[model samples]
Target: MPEPAWRNEGTEPDYRFTLANERTFLAWIRTALALLAGGVLLHQFATELDPRIVVTVLSAGLGVVAAVLSVVSYTRWRANEIAIRQGRPLPFSWVLPALAAVCLLTSAVLVVLLLIA
Candidate 1:
């Protein structure tokens, strides 16, 4: 079998560490999928919320975030793998803070919306 890029570039990392990195990547992908679903559901089925424009904006924001996260996941996975091979500190990713900010904004928007509704 042909070696993957990470496999080819570095000494083999412990299997457990590589598996953990894969899990983290999968988790990010799941989060991205959830955001995509939420955006689609809100846009298509959530007709009762007032200021429907707010809902639309929220939906679009989530979708954009999802797209961004999807791209981030692969880059992060590769960086972490390279770092592991190089025996360097794990590379930092900005996706976490961005994800947190989106979640907090969504929660605040929902809370204010519920209060008004």
Candidate 2:
């Protein structure tokens, strides 16, 4: 029988690692969907607010960030999987910090808009 791609010579396959990566990707996608939904709600339901500008800006920003993160998440997962298969160290340092910063910025913007609205 041919060895599974996730298994290396003389070692059991790491299904845990593959499953964890899949879970992380799904989490990112779910987060992106939530952000998109929030944007849609803000644009459609918050029409009576005094500061439409802030709401609109925040919603648009969140949607764009979510979309970007979704793409980044998928790309990162693929890269990490490839690296693991090839016995190379995973590339995670850059993506982690960037994603954190994006979330922080989005939260701060949302807070500011809420305070002012």
Candidate 3:
């Protein structure tokens, strides 16, 4: 992985593009960190929901999303780097839609839990 970053396989892309890709990957990592924090806070502080499992499930969901994004973001970054080097089209990812769906579903569940509480 480290070697790939330094490899000069294809055309050397601009430092700006590589920097931008690094920033994007950092952003995703930051998002995952925030999600993990939110999950911890909810699990530790929001203790009134009935069935008790609601909070647990919600926290777990956020954790899972965070973990997934942490992994997939690397893959996305690598793909973008490869595309830039090869001068090929970058791959479109489904992560955005999938993330939105996960968040929306989690929000709905939270709303229901709040109502029930």
Candidate 4:
């Protein structure tokens, strides 16, 4: 029989790790959807009829970042799961911090725009 991709030569596969990775991917997807919803809300309800340039820029930037993060997170999670199964060191955990920074910066920009406009 062909060996499972996650199974190593002698060690038992870690199903828990695999499941956790899957969960992480789902969470990223949720985050992306939330960002998209927020952008839609800003475009539809929050912004003025014409919409400020900053508002449109920030919303579009956030939506793009979230979508990119979703793809990156899923790919990284799969790679990490495969690495763990193969007894290799996992990749760095940078996505969360990057996402957080994007959110913070975007919020700051929005606040500044609101105050000025």
Pick by TM-score: which candidate is best? 3
What TM-score goes with each of the models?
Answer: 0.88, 0.73, 0.93, 0.81
Query: With candidate 4 superimposed using the best TM-score fit, by how many Å does residue 73's alpha carbon deviate from the native?
Result: 1.3
Q: How far is 35's C-alpha from truth in model 4 (Å)?
A: 1.2
Q: Which candidate gets the maximum lDDT versus the true structure?
A: 1
lDDT of 3: 0.89
Which digits, one per residue and each the tens of the lDDT, describe model 1 over residues 1-117? 986777677688999999999999999999999999999998898788889999999999999999999999989998999999878999777787878989999989978887888
lDDT of 4 by residue, 1-117 (tens): 996565554354578877887898888888998988888777666565333766787778878987897889778877777777678888888888988998899888777766766
For all candidates in order, the CA lDDT equals: 0.90, 0.76, 0.89, 0.77
TM-score of 3: 0.93
Candidate 1 Cα misplacement greater than 4 A, ranges? 1-6
| Alpha-carbon RMSD of each model | 2.0, 4.4, 1.7, 3.4
TM-score of 1: 0.88
Considering only N, C-alpha and C atoms within 3 Å, which residue pairs clash in candidate 4? Answer: none
Q: What is the lDDT of residue 6 in candidate 2?
A: 48
lDDT of 4: 0.77
Cα-based lDDT at residue 47, candidate 1 = 88
Q: Give me the runs in candidate 4 sitting further than 4 Å from their true place.
A: 1-12, 49-51
